[model samples]
Each structure stands twice: as C-alpha cells, then as structure tokens.
Target: MNYFIFGGSGFIGTHLVNLLKEKYPDGNIYNLDIRENNHDGKSKYINCDVKQPINLNIVVDQNDIIFNFAAVHTTPGHPNHEYFETNIYGAENVTAFAEKFGIKKILFTSSIAPYGASEEMKSEETLPTPNTPYGISKLVAEKIHMIWQAKKDTERQLTIVRPGVVFGKGENGNFTRLYWGIKKHRFFYPGRKDTIKASIYVKELVNFMLYRIEMDRSDVEIYNCTYEPAFTIEEISDAMMKATDMKRTIYKIPGGVLKFAAGIIGALGGKSFGIHPDRVKKLMISTNISGKKLKESDYQFQYSFEEALKDWYNDNDNLYLE
Candidate 1:
C-alpha cells in the first residue's frame, strides 16, 4: 500500500509516520511537508507547500491513501490570516490535488476546538460553534471536503477526525509549558485543580486513522479521537508530581481575580507579562469530549496518561531542569 501524508514533520505527523512504517514494513510511504524530517530513512520525504497548487501526480497515485494533516494549529500569538491561509486554503489545495489524481480515500485531521468551549460533553453530532479563527478555519476546511465529496466523479471516502488535545513526544507549546511547570516544581493550579481536560495519546490517534483507512466504507465518517476516560488538571499534576518525586507549590487563585488580571494585562498590550489574553481564557476554560464512538469501534489505548508522562519526564528531564 502506498501512503502519502501531508505535514509529516509535525508532532502528530511524526508519530503517524513511525506507526505506518512499523505497521507496513515493506510498503511505500511518502511524506510531504514544508521541512524535511530527520527520522529513519524508511519513508520518502518531499518538501512542498500545501497552500499552493502543486502537481503531486508523480508522488501520489490512484491507489494511494492521502492523509491531510497540515494546518496552522491553535497558537495564541498567530494572526487570524495565518490560520485561514494554512488551514482553509491548504485544505482546498490538497483536496483538489487528490480529486485530480483519482485518490479516493482521504483523511482530514480536525480539532474539537470547532465545538468551542462547552461545559457539556461534545460528540460527533454537536453543532460546531467555533470560537477562534483556528477552529473556524478547520470547520470550514471540513465543509470544503464535503463539497468535493458531493461531486459525481469525486467518489472519495472522506474521514474527518475531531481529535482532542493530542500530546506525546516532540510536543511543544501547550504540552511543553505544562511539562516545564511540573519540572520546575512550581506548578500552580488556577481556580479549582479538578478542572477537566480532554486529550488523546498520539499513538491512539494514529491507530484510529489507520483503522479508518483499512475499513473503507462509502459513507463519510466523522469520529472524535480521544481517550475513553477524561482527565482532570489536578489528576495530571498529581501524577507528574509523583513521577518526578517533586513537591510543587499549588496556588488556588480565584477565577474572578485571574480574569480581572487578564483584562488588565490585555489592555496593556501583554508585552510586559509575556502572556497572551487567549492563554488566560484557555487556562480557565474546561474541555471534556466523549470518545464513546472510538471506544465502540473497538479501539484501545496502549498507554495511559501516567505512562505517557513518565516517558516524557525521563526524556526531557535535562531540558526542563534548564
């Protein structure tokens, strides 16, 4: 089987590439990314921009499966236009390329952020009320895929995966920030420590994608790729504290106080604080998604949160200490 992956150098993409190599040892795999990956020499890497129209006919064939994982994911500092250009325009370019080459099976990696900040459990049926440009772009991209799928000649199998916060090795930004907080032994708990956060292990998410690829049904499928059991911030912090043998001081700052401070920081341009207003809002909001669909599909997680954290801690001990 020939597998073509866009954004193969990213955090989730790297893990997906590794899993594909292990699962299909003799199969041909091609990675299309802006930067070349420095991993094992098993897969072919092609540097290309998904935002621009490019002829991938040589690399992508009719029988191959195309996975679009490229996007400008949620970043507090990123401009709104960046998200639209990369997530929306990039998705359109890739889908058009796939249609032109007769590639039928395409998997799009979307986000639960499209559901917005919800207190209720989010499922596949939830109405997408995207809050940020990142979320709006992703949701819009998925809609574009649906439009292509509706065309008569475009007999494509589209699988849209709305995954929760995905964490694993090589993860930067949000995961790195939390890891550093834990490693420094100064982890602070804002509001209540028991704030729930939904997440998926990278391996599990990859497996889900592979499963969808193997079972190619005619219907357009959408699934939430997340762990069955949701986790709380307090639980994650406690596990990290136990794993590192570190005693971190926990602070229970009132939510109102934090909001007020955030407003003040926002009004002042946030340059002096080095923290964005979006980050402050995210910290207070809770995200809990239901992975019932994934579980019902007989997908099982290989590693628990504790196991993932332990591996992460051991690998980045030096970096965190510094």
Candidate 2:
C-alpha cells in the first residue's frame, strides 16, 4: 500500500516516514509539505499546502494510508488567527480529500494542547477544556476528522493521537531549546522543581502509532501519547545534563520573578531575548499527562526518561551547538 503523509517534512513526520521506510522498504511513500524533506530525502516529495484544497492530480488506491500532521502548532509564536486558519482549513481540506478518494484508512496527529495547561495527568477520556487558540483549533479539527469517519464507520479506519511534547533529532522545539539552554549554560528552573512536562521520544511515538494502526481493533480509536509517570522539570534537566555530559550551575528562580524579569528583557531587547514571559509562564505549569491507556495496551515502550535523553544526545549534534 502507498502512504500519503501530509507535513512529512516536519520533525515528527520525517521520523515517521523514516520508520515506515525501514518497515516497508519498497512502500511507495509520498511526502507532501510546503517544505522539502531534508531528513531522508528518499520519500517522493510533493508541494502541498493543507490550508488550501488538497486537489492535486494524485492517484492511489482506496486503501492507501493517509497520515495528517498538517497544522500551525507553536503557541506564543503565531497570531491567534493563524492557528484557526491553518488548523481548521487544513483539517477541512485533508478530510475533504480523503472523502473524495474514499480513503478508508487515515491517521491524524493531534496535540495534547486540547487538554489545556493542566497540572493533573489527563487521560483520553478527560473532557477537554481547551483555553488557547491552538488547543481549541485542534479539538475542533479532531471533530472534523471524526465527522469524516462517521460517514462510514464500519469500513473507515481513523486513529487520532494526541501527543505531548515530542523530541528527537531534527526537532527544534521545546526539548531542543532546553538542550540549547543547558549547552549555553543559561538553563534555569522556573518556579518549582516539580512541574511535570509530559513528553515522549520521537522514535517511540512513531512506533506507538504503527503499533496501534496495525492492531485489529475498533474502527475509530483515540488515545493520548506520552510516557507514563511523566518527568518533572528538574528530573528532565538532570537527565539532559547527564546525557550530554554538560553540567552547569542551574538555579531555581521563582515563577513570578522570572516572568517579570523576562518580560522587561524581552520588551527592551525585542526578539533578541528569546526567553519571553509567556514561555516562562509555560515552564511553571504542569502537563503531567498519563499514558496509562497506552501502557495497558500490548504496545511496549522502548525508551525511558534517561534512555530517551541519551539516545537523542548520541543520535545527532544538530541541536548541540558547540
């Protein structure tokens, strides 16, 4: 079967494509994205903008798997409307394309943002109380995909995955920034040391996705993707330090004080001060999500907090600025 992957050039998508290639060396995988795939450069690339209608003259069987990872997800990074514009339209267009082609098998990579900035570890059953535009848009997009599946539940296969902060090689997101912080000796704990930041390694996440899709179960499956017993901010910091063998004096600053100071610095220095107040606030909050559901499943986790960190460190030096 062929694979049509939207946003395949992105951090997670690239890893997913690579893993898929490993499993099916001869699989016809198409990477559709605005950007090019710099990770493997093996998958057939197509210029696709999910915000617009995905009406390309493409040919694939009805059973070809479609993976949707298209969205504008970074918070405090994009304008409020950008989130809705990209996410909503992307969902509409992708689902529209799927319906048109009668593609029964589809997988969507949603976000844990729908759970909002909660201190409690939320399950898949947790009633989403989304606060941010990113969160709200994603929750809505989940509905959009579900609607498509509703048209033909007995035959359609739709798997929705809400993953927390995912990190690995080529990922220039939170974990990369954290690694940069420690490397530059600017890493510091905001507020308390116990704030849980639910996260997962990219490879493990890809494996989990494949495992679930291959399962002969329900037609529509929704689950939260994260490592169980999520790591605290301090624990992550310690593990990261040990992984790269880069230890420095990291001080725990109170949340309020750090936010205030960062706000002023960010205002004066403009974008030069990457440490914005909103970012500081995020660090203080807890995203302690439970992977209890995933754990209960037959899918086994190959990486732990320490092991994931070590694997990433040894995997590449892209984020490791000397």
Candidate 3:
C-alpha cells in the first residue's frame, strides 16, 4: 500500500504521517507538500504545492490513497481572497491529480467552520450555513472532491472529516493559547464559562480518520469529528488545572466590559493579547458540534478531555512548569 498525503507538513498531516508509519511500516508514505515534514525526518517528502499542478517528479500508483490536508484555514488571519485561492484551487489541483493518476481513495481534513458558529449543537447532517470566507471555501472544496467521487462511482472512496478545533503538542492555535495562559496563571475568560469549545485531540482525530476509511461502508462518509457533549470553557479549565496540579486564578470579565475593551483595541488595530472584537465575539459564541455519526458507527474514543489534558501534561511537563 502507498499513501500520497498533500499538505503533509502541517500539524494534522505530520501526526497522520507518524500514525501511518507506525501502523503500516511496510507502506510507502509520501508527503507531497511544498514544505518538508519537520516532525518526521524519515518521511519521504515530495516537494509539491496544491495551488499549482502537482508534479512530484514521480508516478503515483492507481491504488495509492491521497489525503488532502492543505488549506488556508485560519479565520481572521488571511485575506478573504487567500482562502478561495488556496482552498478551492488546491482542491481542483488535487482532484485533477487524482483523476490523472487513477488514485481510488481520497481522505480530506475539512473544518467544522462550514457549519459556521452555532449556538445549538450541530451534527454531520445539519445544513451547512457557512458565513466566513474560510467556511465557504472549505464547503466548496468538499464539493469539488465529492464531484470526483461521483464521477469515479463505486471505484472511489472519499472520506471527508469536518473536525472542530484540533489540538495537541506543536499546535500553536487556540488550545495552545489556553495552555500557555493557564500555565502562566494569567488565563481568564472574557464572559461566561459555559461557552462551548468543541474540540478533538490530534491523535484521536487522526485515528478516527484511519478507522473510518477501514470500517465505514459508504462510498463517501462525511463525519463531524469532535468529542461528544462538547467541553465548555469551565470544563476545559478544570481539566487543565487538574492535569497540571495547579490552582491558578481564573477570572471572568463581564461581556460588556470585554466588548468595550475590544472596541478600543480594535480601533488601535491591536491583536497581541489574543483579544479583538471578532475573537471576543467568538469566545461568547458556542460551537456545540457532535460526532454522533462516528459514535453510531461503534467507534470508541481513546481519550476524554480530562485524559487528553493529562496526556498532554505528561508530554510537556517541563515546558508547562517552566
């Protein structure tokens, strides 16, 4: 078996490569990414960009599976045009390459952003009402891959995963911010503690993707990948504190006060403290996403939020303590 993973230098991609290598050591795992795989030096890195035509300087076998993890995913980070340029065009390039190479399977890591920010918990079957540029682009990308799957018919297998905030070691996003702030004893919420942070550990999310490919029967199985009964800010705080064995002070500023502060910061064009109007609004909003489809498939999660926190603490105890 051979694996051709696009954007394989990313956080999820890196971990996925590690998982594949460990699971199938005999399988030839090729990372077709513009950047080299920093996490695994043993990985066979093929220099290719998904925005352009992929030319790995080598031929891809028909049975080789492709995993597309490349995209401009960070919201309020990239220009609106960048998302469409990278994500949509990237999808086009990937599917075209797959068609040309006769690759039979494609696994894509899309985001829960397509469902947009919702107060109620959303399932995989929920109507996608994407509001942001990132969200819209991802939805379109999924469609592009689906079109390929439809054209290939029964011969193709397409697994699309819409994961909520995925976090672990080396991922310097929302969760990392929380970890560092909490470690520094400066972690606090801008509003109520009940706001949901629908998330998954990086290892488990990757595990589920591999499992879905092997177990699910559908030609195309789209799953909303995240922990069920999503962890709220309070729960997350409690887990982190317990895991670290630290009794750090957690303050909750009033929403109105936070908005006022964000207004001033926004006027000044400052986003240094991980605070801004948009971020403040995001903190207040609840994204209660469900992974009922995976659960219904009899998939078991290896780690809960608490267990994941402890595992993370164990891995990075020195960094967290220092």
Q: lDDT values of the candidates?
A: 0.77, 0.85, 0.83
Instruction: Give the number of the best model, judged by lDDT.
Output: 2
Model 1 residue 142 distance off true place after TM-score fit, in angstroms:
0.8
Q: Would you list the rank order by lDDT, best first?
A: 2, 3, 1
Candidate 2's TM-score: 0.95
Residue range 1-322, candidate 3, lDDT tens digits: 7788888888888789889989988888888787887455647887887899876677669877888998888767889999999999999999999999898889998988999887988998899999999999999999999999999677889999988888887687888777767776645687799999888988898898788766434398789888877889888878877877878878998887888887897788765565666777888898899977776777788898788777766768644621
Stretches of candidate 3 off by over 4 Å are 215-218, 262-272
Which pairs, if any, clash in model 2?
none
Tell me the lDDT of candidate 2: 0.85
Clashes of 2: 0
Tens digits of per-residue lDDT for model 2 on 72-144? 9887989999999989999999999988888887899999999888787799989999999999999999999
Model 2 residue 311 CA deviation in Å: 1.2
**Taking the tens digit of each residue's C-alpha lDDT, what string does model 1 give over 226-247?**
7767778887667767766667
lDDT for model 3 comes to 0.83
RMSD of each: 3.1, 1.9, 2.1
